[model samples]
Target: MLTLSIFAVLLLMLLIDIPIAVAIGLTAVVFFVAQGQSSFLAMLPQRMYSGTTGFTLLAIPFFILAGNLMNCGGTTQRLFRFARALVGHVPGGVGQVSVVSSMIFSGMSGSAVADAAGLGQIQHRAMVDAGYKPTISAAIVAGASTIGPVIPPSIPFVLYGAITSVSVSRLFLAGAIPGAVMGLAMMLAIWLMAKPRNLPKDPRANLHEIWDSFTAAFLPLMAPVIIIGGITTGFFTPTEASVIASLYALALGFLYRDLTWKEIPAILFTSLKQTCGLMFIIATANFFGWFTIFERIPDALITQLAAFGTTATGFIWIVIAIVLVLGCFIDGNAIFLITLPIFMKLCPLYGVDMVNFGVVMTLLIMIGNLTPPVGMCLFAVESFAKVGIWSLAYECFPYLIAILAVTILCAFVPEIALWLPNYVMGAAG
Candidate 1:
C-alpha cells in the first residue's frame, strides 16, 4: 500500500507537469512526512551531495563542454560534408547523410538534443532545400539524433555507470558495435523508403571531392578516436578523456578560426547551465533512489517477479518495455535514475551481465528520446520544422522501427554489445 501510494503520487506529479527534479524530491519528502519519518529529512542534503560526488560523473561537464566547443568550432558542418561526400549519392541521399553524420557527431557530443539542435539544423535545411517534405526532414533529423546517445562517450552511459558502479570504459566499448548497427539499420530503412518517398539523391562526389571533405573534417573526426583510444590503452580514464576531448575541440576551434575568444564565455556558460540541470536531477534522483531502497521496493519487486519465475531474457524484455512506455511520458534520465536501483538488484538474481544490460538500457533510453509527448529530439527538430509533434512522430516511424529492431536484436544477443568491450577490455571482472 505504501509503495503504491508513493508511485501514485509521483505519477500524479509528473502528469500535472511539475519539474522532474522537484517532483521527485517533493515526492520523497511528502512520503517521509506521511510516514512520520520526517527526522530522516535532515539527511537529504548529504544524500544529494553523495550522488553528485562520483568521480565517473566528473566526465559530464567536460563532455558537455567538448560538445559545446565542437558545435561552436564548426565541427558539425565538416562532419556533415564528409558524410555527404561519402554517401550522398545513395538512394536516400541526404537522408543517408543525416544518419552517417549523426553517428560520427554522436561520438563527439554524447547527447541527442545537441545532435538534433546543432547538426540537425544543417541536415534539416539541406534536406528541405533538396526537396524533402518538412515533416520527413524533421523526422529524419530527430531519428538520427537518437544515435548520438548510443555511440561512445554517451552522457547517459556515464550516469548509468556512475550510479550502478559499472565500468565507463567498458560501457563505451559495448556501445560501438550496437551504435554502428543502429546507423546501418537506419540507413537501410531509408534506402527501402527512398523510391516510394522519391527521396532526392545528391550527385555522387568524385574521389577528389571526397578527399577534400575528409581532409577538411580530419581533426574533428579524431575527437572520438582520441577519447576511446586513450581509455582503452589506459593512458586516461573516461574523466580525463573528457578533458582531453574539450582541449582538443578548443584547439581545433582556434586552428580553424571558426570559434573566437569572444564566444568562449557563452559556450562555457551554456555548458555550465546544462551541467547544473543534469546534476540537480542526479541529486534528486539519488534521494528518490534511496527512498525506494528504504521502502524495500526492490525487494518487493523481486518477490513479485520471482513469483512469475522470470528468466534473465524475460527480465530484459520487461525492462525494455518499461523504458519504452515510460520514455513516452518522462525524460530519459529521470526514468533511468528512478528504475535503475531496482533493476540492478534483478540483474544479479537473474544472472544478467551488467555490461550487456547497461548497453541495452542505454539503447532503450535512446529510443525513448525519440518518442512522443516529451521526446527531447522531437522538440529540438520541431523548433525549426514547425511540423506538429505527432506528425513528426508518425514520419519517424520507419526509423524508429529500424532502431527498435536493433534494440530487440541486442536484447536477444548479449554478445552483440558484449563482444567489442570484452575484446578490447579483456572482459569485465
Candidate 2:
C-alpha cells in the first residue's frame, strides 16, 4: 500500500509538471510522514549532505568549469577546425563533422546539452549553407551529442559511481569501446542517409592545412589525455583530475590570451548555476533513495521478479526495457539518480559487473537525450538550428535505430563494454 501510494503521488506530481527534484523530495516526505516515522525526517538532511559532500562530487563543478573555460577560451573552435579538416570532405560533410566533433568533445565536456549547443551552431550553419535540410541538420546534431556521456570524463559515469559505489576509473575505461562503436554507428547512418542526396562535400584539406589545424588544436586535444592519464596512472583521483582540468583551462584562457578577464565572471557564474542545479538534484535524489531503501523496494522487486524466472539475461532485458521506456519521458540525469539505487541492489544477483552495468545504463539513458517530449539535447539542437521539433524527430529515425543497435550490442555482449577496463586494470595489477 505504501509503495502504491508513493508511486501514485510521484505520478501525480509528474502529470502536474512539478520539478523532478521537488517532486521526489515532496513525495518522500509525504510517504515517510504518513508512515508516522517522524524520525525518518532526520535522515533527510544526512542523506542530502552525504550525497553532495562526497569527494567524487567535487569533480562535477570542476568539469563544468573546465567545459566553460574551454568554450570561452576558443578551444571548441580549434577542435572544430581539426574535425572539419578530417571529415568535411566526406559525403554529408558537415554532418560527419558533427559526429566526429561530438566524439572528441565528449572526452572533454561530458554534457550532451553542452555538445549540442557548442557544435550545433557551427554544424547547423554549415549544413544549411551547403543545402541540407534544417531537420536533418538538427537530427544529426542531436544524435551525435548523445555520444558525450558514452565517452570518458562522462558526468553520468561520475554520478553513477557516486550512487553505486562502483569504480569511476573502471567505468571510464569500460565506455571506450561502446563510445567508439556508437560514433561509428552514427557515421554509417549519416553516410547511408546522405548518399542518396549527393550532399555537397568540401574539398579535402591538403597535408599542410591538416597539420596547421592539428597544431592549433593540440593543446585542447591533450586536455582529455591529461585528465584520463592522471586518473589511470594513479597520479590523482577523478576529482583531482577535474581540478587540474580547470587549472589547465584557466591557463589556456588567461595566459594564452584566449579568454579575457571580462569573460571570467560570466563563465564562473554560468558554471556555478549549472553546478547548483545538478547538486540539488543529486541531494534530493539521495533523500528519495533513502526512502526507497527504507521501503525495501529493491528487495520487493527482486522477490516479485523471481517468480517470473530471474535468469541473468531475463533480468537485464527487463531493466533495458524499463529504462528505454521511462527514458522517453524523463531526463537522463533524473533517470540515473532515481533508478541507480534500484539497479545496484539487483545487479549482483544477475552476476552483472557493476562497472559494465554502469556503462550500459549511462548509454541507455543518454538515448533519451535524442527522443521526444523532454530530450534536452533535442530541444537544444532544434533551437540552435531553427528546425521544427517534429520534423527533426522524423529525420532522427535512422540515427535512432543506430543508437538502439549499439545499445543492444552492448547489453548482450558485456565484454564489449568490459574489455578495455579489464585489460587496463589487469596490466596495472
RMSD of each: 1.1, 1.7
Per-model TM-score on C-alpha atoms = 0.98, 0.96
Error of 2 at 265 (Å): 0.8
Model 1 lDDT, residue 390, Cα: 93
Model 1, span 1-429: residue lDDT tens? 676788789878988999989999999999999889999999899999999999999999999998889888789899999999999999999999999999999988899888898889999999999999999999999999999888998998999999899999999999999999999999999999999999999998999999999999998998899899999999999999989989998999999899999999999999999999999999999999999999899999899889999888888889988889888877888988899988999899988888888888888877777788888899989998899999999998998888889988988898999999888778743
Best by TM-score: 1
Cα miss at 71, model 1 (Å)?
Answer: 1.2
Alpha-carbon local distance difference test for all models: 0.91, 0.84
After aligning candidate 1 to the native by TM-score, how far in Å is the CA of 39 from where it should be? 1.1
Question: What digit string (tens of lDDT, one per residue) describes model 2 on residues 1-429?
Answer: 556677679767877899888887888998888888878798888998888998887888988888778777777778888999999898778889889988988888777887888766777877788788778878888898889888888889888888887888888888988999999999998887777877777899899889999998898889889988888889898888888988988987776688888888999999999999889888998899888998999888888878887799898888889888777777788788888888899998888878878988888887787777777888888886777777887788888788889888988898998888888877333
Worst 10 residues of 2 by lDDT: 420-429
